[model samples]
Target: MAGQKGDPVMVDERRFTSFADGETSLELHGLTFENGTDALAVYGNGVFTRDAAGRAALAAVVDVLRRAVAALDEAGPAAQALPDGDGRGDGATSVANPFG
Candidate 1:
């Protein structure tokens, strides 16, 4: 969303997924956004079992790195898919846009 001079615009969130079980279990999520800059701003965190965390963490990092490189050519963190496009694309974000 955009602001209109003084009107508050609906937040154009760079949403991502997360999972958790109470406070002692696990949580995982990632997010990104396009500011008025040359690239997208991104941040994220995840929690998982020590037994499996390594694989999952590596997978997520590898994914974002690959996607960012492909999408932004290492200029800035960036990866987004068209609303209609579907594939293993865009930092592992879900390709099917239910919102669209």
Candidate 2:
């Protein structure tokens, strides 16, 4: 989107259209779970503009998101490994003991 220098930048909004055919795929027995995904295509017919700083900032944001996602993935297994406090595991001992 472009306009006079003094004018506010207005992004030319375009409606998104999607077409999908019925398809099915089987999942493998074991795979690391990844939660989110994005697919984007930016193209224009006649003219285009590039903003290096803006692109760099966008990349930085994506990197931050990836790290955040990795941290969440790492936390999930640890959380699952912990006992659920119903006194059902060998991981943690009960509070009533002979050491009193």
lDDT of 1 by residue, 1-100 (tens): 1111222112233232111111221122343322222233444554434667667665554454344344333323333432443433344664687788
On TM-score, the leading prediction is: 1
Highest-lDDT candidate: 1
RMSD of each: 17.4, 18.9
lDDT of each: 0.35, 0.31
Candidate 2: give the clashing pairs: none
* TM-score versus the correct structure, for each prediction: 0.30, 0.27
For model 2, state the Cα shift of residue 98 in Å.
62
Measured on C-alpha atoms, candidate 2 has an lDDT of 0.31
